[model samples]
Target chain A: MTSIINVSNLSKTYEGGFQALKSVNLEIKDGEIFALLGPNGAGKTTLISIICGLVNASEGSVTVGGFDIIRDYRQTRALIGLVPQELTTEAFETVRQNVSFTRGLFGKPKNPDLIEKILRDLSLWDKKDERIMNLSGGMKRRLLIAKALSHEPQILFLDEPTAGVDVELRKDMWNVVRDLQTSGVTIILTTHYIEEAEEMADRVGIITGGEIVLVEGKEALMNKLGSKQLTLDLLTPLEKIPESLIAHDLRLDNGGTNLVYTYDSKSDRTGITSLLNDLSANGVKFTDLKTNQSSLEDIFVDLVKQSS
Target chain B: MNLRAIKAIYLFEMSRTMRTLAQSLISPVVSTILYFVVFGSAIGSRIQEIDGVGYGTFIVPGLIMLTVLTQSMSNASFGIYFPRFIGTIYEVLSAPISHLEVIVGYVGAAATKSTILGLIILITAGFFVDLQIAHPFYMFLFLILTSVTFSLFGFIIGIWADNFEKLQIIPLLVITPLTFLGGSFYSVSMLPPFWQTVTLFNPILYLVSGFRWSFFENADVSVGVSLSMIALFLMICVLIVWWIFKTGYRLKD
Candidate 1:
């Protein structure tokens, strides 16, 4: 896939000498959901702000759809939509007015039909005439999304879109994001929720300490670092692991009623059969067995720990 | 020029004015009428005249100037400050519109509101006193200039201020005092000679004098100096606004 956004050697240092982003480079593929996962103050918002032209970078350059962000701000910004992390709407303005005004800000002519569709899609049609301040927090967030999508931008940046959202609203927002992706809009979102990144991202970029530590396809990254844990229910309680089972990465759990073996799932030799044979030989019998695969959360924690 | 963007911002701000008509329009007019009641009627009967114009009539331009200056600054400052406070400024900053267009939209709306308020007060002033305009065109010219100039000043204050208290500082502590001392209630010529020279240093004196001149064709300073001072101040404000946008000071991190 062709890249829609290109960033090279980007760095940002604020007035007080705090470096928020450092030599960070990234490329977002066209029409793909790319999740930027990072801890707070890891420069995720800073990165998004710079690309959206709300904040200036201290150094480096960024281009969206072959146009430099600074040199061609209008042209580049016209193609981008940003739903900021903060739930900020014109409190006194009606929902429809806020959305329509945002479209006009992009120099798009008034199109009530388009605005209506976006509002309906976001489930904000019923509340279109209500003042924003009167809406519930979830409804307000949806309004922000409607405003962002009012101009039908090619690229949408959702900064912590689901932050502070309830489970139902988060699920709704995820569906909204997925629907946008199906319509061929490239999405770049920053999130601390590992499950959100796991569920929505085609690719994941892990950032820490003002740097892009790793960027990889979600499936590939998981498989590369994923480990499987095989839990064996003991026929009888054991005080400790048998000497023969010591060679395997095994641990006793559940008050010695379970013996758990951990092994790389991607490895050619899991040695499950050999481990089973040794277990029987050592007089350790299992009544039942189950395996658990490591999740994206584990890998994320590992990456952050290693990088820091 | 992104006229659509400008119109969008302008309409949004204008609608806000409409929604708060009681505070934005009614309050100022009511206060000005009160001024005409106390100063125009009570003082006018006693003093009769100052600078050869009726006491009531002489203070009309100055009263309008007081309201115009304060209204322009407060309106424009609050116009931009609220967005920053609520974090909606991100939408405008991230939009395809240029900084100049953003300024034109906000400052233009503010100046329009203040100018309307000034004209409304002018019309209302006519009810209490026999007001005469020697130069109607210059009167309007001064009105527009003062509105636009101080609106720009307020825009700068909006960007510079980070809190509600900071936003009110310049208007209350600086602009309001300067306008009062700038001879809004009385003529500087009536003051002793030393004080007249001292009053010349007040920047608002030029705005008040220039506006008052357009009314009676009489002023403490030459019309040329007043006009030059206003034009120079306008240019300085424009330059400062340009610098703010160029450097992204307070607007960008």
Candidate 2:
């Protein structure tokens, strides 16, 4: 895969001595969905802003499609479509006009068919003649997507794309993104929703405090750090955990009716079979046993905590 | 700026402004009619003539300029400020349109609105008084120059403003007062020598005088000086706007 975006030693420092981004580097490949996960004010927006030419980077350099972002701004901007976190369509403008105007902004000749296709793809064709202010929030978000995609950009940046969106819109947007990916358009998405990252991202980059802590394949990150929980329901309630069973690092809950054990999923010995044998030997019998796999949420929380 | 992008922005901005037609065109016509009733009749009754022109006819250009300045400033500032207030500025800035294209598009729309209003006021003033145009060509020249200058000035205000209140600050405190005190109702010659000298500092004085010259045929100041001052003022405003766009001063960061 070819690299669509390359950042080297990128940092951003605002006035009055506030550092929004530290020295960081990242490479986003073409035709893949890359998710940047971070908490609020973690420089996700700032980084995206710099790449979009909305803000100037204080230090370092970035190139989009082999074009330096600052020097070759026109070409770079033409190559990239940005769906900012804000829902900022012209309120009084018809949806079709807004999308068409955006396409013309790139100096592209009028392409009514392309505009119609974009609006239809985003499910906004029905409201093509409606004013933007009359549309609901989800429709407005989709309109933003349509406007960004009107020029048929090679790469797209979605800054907090699904923030404050309904579940139906979220799912709908996921389908739209999946469609874009299938068409070979590279996507870089920043999201606070770990589930979104887990479901959509081919690779995940965890950023904390203006720095990228780790960038790895989604499954690899989970397998390296994800932990699983095993719960055993007791046949009868007990006062406390037995002294002999203290070596298992199990926690008793609900008046000792259940025992929960957490261990690394990647560990060679999960200790489940041995713990069950020991429990039987010690006369601590359970009527049932169940295991729950760790989710991406668990792995994300652990990564952010360790990095921070 | 790419001509295609600028043209697109220009068309878009114009459509947005036209959507508020009732408030844009009708409001000004109504207000101009009120000005004819209140200022032209009530004030004209007490005063007969100034500089050999009837009181009613003499105040026509100034009244038109007043409408032109205020309307242009309001339209331009609100047109851009609303997008920022609603967070649509990000969409505009992220587009392929250059800063210059954005400024020209918005300011051009504002100039169009104000020019149209000025023409309406001129026609409305004719209904109240038989005003004679001494130089129709110069009248068009001054009208266009004043509208463009104020439109650009309002563009700067739009970029600097952070909120709706900030957007109205210049129109309320600066543009309106300047028009009113800059001899919009009376000639600078009517004031004392010291005051007249001070009036020279009011930029709108040149626009008012320049516009009035085209109506009254002969005024205290030569038409050449008034037109020269207005032209120079427009050039300075254009330069500043260009610098603002080039630096990305308030609009970008």
Candidate 3:
């Protein structure tokens, strides 16, 4: 995929001398679900704001759809839609009016058909004429998406769309995002929910302390940093691991009833055969064995931990 | 030009006024009526006329100017300030709009509202006082210029203000006071000599004098000076608004 959004050596330093973003560089593919993952105060929102033209960068530059964000602001911003983290709607405005207003702000002609479709897709059609203040938290969150999609932007930025949202709604939003991606809209999201990134992103990026620690395909990241574990539930509790099996990395779990062995899932030599033989020789009997592969969350935790 | 965007903003603001019609329209109109009923009636019947006009007729232009000044500022200030307060300003900032378009949409809506309110009050004032428009064109031109200029000023206040209290500070403490002391109820000639000299310095005086001259062709100051003062003030407001967008001041960080 071609790069549709490019950030070249971007930095943002606030008036109070708080450096929100370091010298950062990134590129988002033309049509992909890219998740920017980070902990609290990791500058995720700041980066997204700069690209959307909501915040000015102190140094460096960004371009959306090959148009410079600042010099061709109208062209760049016209191609993008932003759902900010804040649940900010015109409280007095009806749902339909709120969504339709955004279409105009994004320079799109009024199209009630498109507005109806968006509201219906988000399950907000029934509440179209109702005041926004009357909607539930989940509905309000969906309204943000509907408003963002009003102008049919080629790219959408979801800044913590699922934050403070319930699980069912989050899953529902994940599906909506998937549908958006299928419809050919590139999505870039900033989130602290690692699972959110895992469940939706084609590529995952980990940021820590204003810097990107790593960016890779979700599966590649999991495989690269993910470790697997084989837990041996023994019939007899061992006093200790015998010295003969010392070479194999092992640990006692469940108060000595289980002997767990950990190894890189990607590595060819797991040494399970040699460890089993050595275990038998030492009378370390096991009734059952089960293997567990690490998940993206595990890799993310490790990556963030290492960076910070 | 972003005319569609401008229309959206303009209609959205007008809709807000429609939603609260009592407050936006009726309340101001009622207050103007009260001023006419009491000050223009009870007081005017006893006080002598000034500049060959009845006391009731003399205050008509001042009342409209007072309404336009406060309404323009509050309408425009509140229009922009509410979005910033609620955090919907992000949508505005990220929209594909130029700063001029943003100002035009907001200030235009504000000026429209205030001008309409001013006109409504003028019609209402005629019921209480004998009204005349020596130059109808200048009457409208002065009203519109004052509205647009003060609406821009209110836009600045909206951006500068961080809280509700700050929003009310300028319009309430500074502007309302200046309007009252700047001959809203009496002619500048009625004030003592030193006070008259001091009142001449109030910008609202020029606005009031210019607007009054459009009606009665009698003003405390020359129409040229009034026109120049308003033009200078309008230019200054435009300058500040430009700086705000260029620097991203309180709107962005």
Per-candidate total of colliding backbone pairs: 0, 0, 0
TM-score for predicted model 3 compared with the true structure: 0.92
Candidate 2 Cα deviation (angstroms), residue A275: 9.5
- On residues A1-308, what C-alpha lDDT tens digit does candidate 1 reach at each position? 99999999999999999999999999999999999999999999999999999999999999999999999999999999999998888789999999999999999999999999888888889999999999998999999999999998999999999988898888878888999999999999999998888888999999988999899999897786578999999999899987878999999999999999999888899989899999888888879999998777777788788978
> Candidates 1 and 2: which is better by TM-score?
1
Candidate 3 lDDT at B177 equals 96
Q: Which candidate gets the maximum lDDT versus the true structure?
A: 1
Per-model CA lDDT versus the true structure? 0.92, 0.85, 0.91
The candidate 3 chain A region of ten consecutive residues with least summed lDDT is A218-227
Q: Give the top-scoring candidate (DockQ).
A: 1
lDDT, candidate 1, at A118: 87
Candidate 3 segments exceeding 4 Å error: A229-269, A278-293
Which is superior by DockQ, 1 or 3?
A: 1
What ordering of candidates by lDDT runs from best to worst? Answer: 1, 3, 2
Clashing pairs in 3: none
Error of 1 at B129 (Å): 0.8
Q: Local error of candidate 1 at A303, Å?
A: 0.9
- After superposition, which runs of candidate 1 have C-alpha atoms over 4 Å from their true positions? A229-269, A275-292
lDDT of 1 at A168: 86
For candidate 1, what is the lDDT? 0.92
Task: After the best TM-score superposition of candidate 2, give how far the Cα of residue A99 lies from its true spot, in angstroms.
Answer: 1.9
